[model samples]
Target: MNCLRSILAAGLASLVLFPAPVRAQKTGEAPGVQGSKNIRSMKEIRDEGVVKQRWDVSCGAAALSTLLTYDFKDDTPETSIVVWLLHRVDAKRVRSRGGFSLLDLKHFSEARGYHAEAFSGMSIEDLALEKTSVIVPIREKGFDHFVVVKGFVAGHVILGDPGFGNVTMRVDRFQTLWKDGIVFVVHPPDDRMIGEKRLPVAARLVPDESLISRKIGVTAPSNYLY
Candidate 1:
């Protein structure tokens, strides 16, 4: 009995002297599992202009509305865009086309008095030079969808997704999902220019244009001219 008691005492002393190391919990990790430190959160893409798509097939219209409302301060309604495009083509044809096309967005933007242009083979680095937010089509779940590229935050692409609200994606992931590296760039309407130049929505979110530029290895434009 004394020997058994001695063994127990020694074991308790050893435990007190050398407690097992406790693993530190990582940020964004589940209870005991180590999780990705790169976990991202959805932040408001714009202070006053994120427009969610009211219908499953209206992502293009909603994305256009978001860009016009936020970047150009146009306050265009998604329904107006939808109505305008539907009048140009049959509703059944739009449904058959899978959704509103980038061409439709271009036409609507022009109708609203914004200068819209489409470019292919534009890299994310190219996007860093843009002075305004752009609309990009990406393949999501085997379907083509439109999302507004607000700007780069750190190494992630900030997006104003009409269907999913504001979101961000890693650059590599965005590249993988981006369709043909196509970008739709829009300039503010000529008639309603703001007297004072304002920062782009992404710049407002990060507030450090130099930092974003440095992080992305490209110089961003000084201001998103209205």
Candidate 2:
């Protein structure tokens, strides 16, 4: 690792001194659920600026779910973003709980999370310290909204590795971000039981013998941006 870093450092140093023309790489982001509720569907039709965003949380609380999306005017490989999540829940409105997160994808394009140490490639930690950005404070207006900042790999997972089997399924937990670490939560989105089938309980919340989150399911397209 040291040798690789030294070699990269030397090359970058030479780039500074020589300032030669550099070819650009392909543009891509990672595979992520939409992060907006206003969006009617998650089909890959066009890159219109009007597309709303929502996120597919694995486990939700109080019978609720959320999705988020972002429209790019000039979001090439050079662009980065930071998002903040604000969680908002209402006792009266048992449905449609609210929460939002913030991330920094605009300035800092390379940084590593602690877990990135496992990957053979550059972890979020290996980010160069030339252009460090801050997580802007976007106020929480409704139920949930805040800030989330990730390195270069964030967009990769959201826009890359195209899949066709996107399904809104229940899981033991939906991943979350704390102040400086990652967290797994087992809370079910507030949902009501109906008919012969009851609302399945979430494994993340607790194993209930009676209900589960299998009833409220949404199957989205794998390739959202076609």
Best by TM-score: 1
Candidate 2 residue spans exceeding 4 A from truth: 1-42, 45-155, 159-179, 185-226
lDDT of 1 by residue, 1-226 (tens): 0000001222322221112232333567678786755322113322335687776677778888987876777788999999999899678766655567777778888887777888888898898877777888776444566778877766767776665455556788889978777888888766455323233343323221111211111111111112
Displacement of the residue 174 alpha carbon in candidate 1, Å: 0.4
lDDT of 1 at 219: 18
lDDT of 1 at 93: 61
Model 2, residue 16: C-alpha shift (Å): 26
Per-candidate local distance difference test: 0.61, 0.18
